[model samples]
Target: MELGTSLEKRKVPNMLKRILQYDVQLTKKFVDLALRTTTLKSLRNHAKLFEVSCHGIVWLACWLSFIWLFNNKELYQLQVNMFIALILDIVVIAVIKAFVRRRRPVPMNKLMELGPDKFSFPSGHTSRAVLVAFILICLNPISIIFYPPLLAWVTAVSISRVLQERHYLLDVVCGAGVGLLEGLFMALIWFSQSASASILSSLSDEKLDGGEYHV
Candidate 1:
């Protein structure tokens, strides 16, 4: 069983790498077409705004605001878990980018300002965006209401990473997957603790209300 599990793990990465290779070719063609077609002056100007949104400072400020707002202990824990997940995503992306050591697309000036990140196997911006969006969507009771606009923003962020030439299509795709996995991991840990606490609280309430005495 262990051998089979190990084999499956090895196969999965190999499969994903093959998919990335094909995706790169498709993305190159698509990006070429997009660049030629996107001639609108007004639209071009807005790309910088999208680029600015991807920076670390913007996310840091947003997280700080959330930390300030969620003062309740339970809510505070949730926010902290999310913050940790974002940090994990960043660290994982940094390590993977270093290991992959993939080169960025040339003519660096065409990329959005702030130059380019050192390597580009996976997009940190796309990952962080997806991580934040996924956590918010899952944690909120009114996620249905948030879904449409939130997904639009997520899609825009992913596309921007590609169009700006900061990442290939596969990088954004893989980054999104990684972000989701991290979010789910944190959610499970947080919720499990919450469930256990609720159970303990209920048990204590029963003992007190019933006036049960232990020898």
Candidate 2:
């Protein structure tokens, strides 16, 4: 019985190792196929456009600047919550990437590499895309007519990560899941207009005029 127990414990680790190896091999095969197929290659090239659109730094900077400059009462709640959510997304992605330390499918140029950017287990762009889409759609930030485009953007961003050989299939999949969870978490702890205003007030010298704002 003791020998059987020992063998079972050893087999568990071997099983996990095999699963990880299979994942890597499968991702390599898919990336190679994408490179060889003309249609896929073109799609990958186009997908690069979407990748640039969802860059984390750009989104954060734009949102932060908007929050500081515009300060429109109509968009106060969304702007604040979204800005905070973006920060939350960045922190979560950075923590996970640091913990996983998974290498990208291709080595990034040293000049472009940033902290946590070298890891590939979860695509930061994918997560950010998903989080933004979820907020825009579920939160009804804009007219419902924009839902389709928002969803399409998220889908494109997620697929582009894999097609561009920036991440494994599992990485994109897990990223979407993470983004969805972050959206739900933000919803649960959603800041009220007053809460958002107070937080923003503390950060900036801006004072809200005596007016009611609705989300």
Candidate 3:
């Protein structure tokens, strides 16, 4: 029994190592193919557009700007929740990236200079894309017609990460999974309209008067 248990323990790690090596090689092949197929500068630039659209900083700025401009209660609540979701997404991503510390498939020295951390086990952009899409679909804040386009955006964002050599295939796959879990968590602990409003009001140091804002 002791011998059998020792062998089983040894085999499990070896199996995991083999799987990791295979994943790396496969991701390299896909990245190489993408580079060859998208040799054109314009094509590469277009893929970058998809990447930038789903960047964490861009999402944060856009959501905050929308909240500042729109006062509709429904819109306000949605924006506030989204803002909170983004923060949660950032915290989760940061924690995982720090712990994993995996290198990007392609070394981006310039990009690395822009950010302190260079780990890329899970694609943040892909996670953000999936999270946003899931939230929109679940909430149905916009017309049903928008869901298809939202899904397309998520697909594009995910593919763009691999094509750009910013992340491995497994990184993106796991990122989507993480994003789904985060969305489900957000749904479970979602704030009510009044709660959202009160939180925002407190942050801005504004008072509510007779169930209305007076600032």
- Runs in model 1 deviating more than 4 A are 1-24, 36-45, 69-74, 108-116, 140-143, 191-215
Clashing pairs in 2: none
lDDT of 3 by residue, 57-146 (tens): 998998887777666666657877899899999999999998777777654334622245578878889889988988888853677899
Error of 1 at 201 (Å): 20
Off by over 4 Å in 2: 1-12, 36-39, 107-116, 207-215
lDDT of 2 by residue, 1-215 (tens): 99999667656466767876787788778767877899777777787688889988899889987876676666778988898889999999999998777778762324432344678978889899999988887863778888888888888788778877778888898999999999999999888888877777776654454333434
Best-to-worst lDDT order: 2, 3, 1
Off by over 4 Å in 3: 1-12, 35-43, 107-116, 205-215
* Candidates 1 and 2 compared by TM-score, better number: 2
Per-residue lDDT of candidate 1, residues 68-96 (tens digit): 54444445445566666767887888889
lDDT of 3 at 187: 94
Backbone clash total for model 2 is 0
Q: Each model's C-alpha lDDT?
A: 0.68, 0.80, 0.78
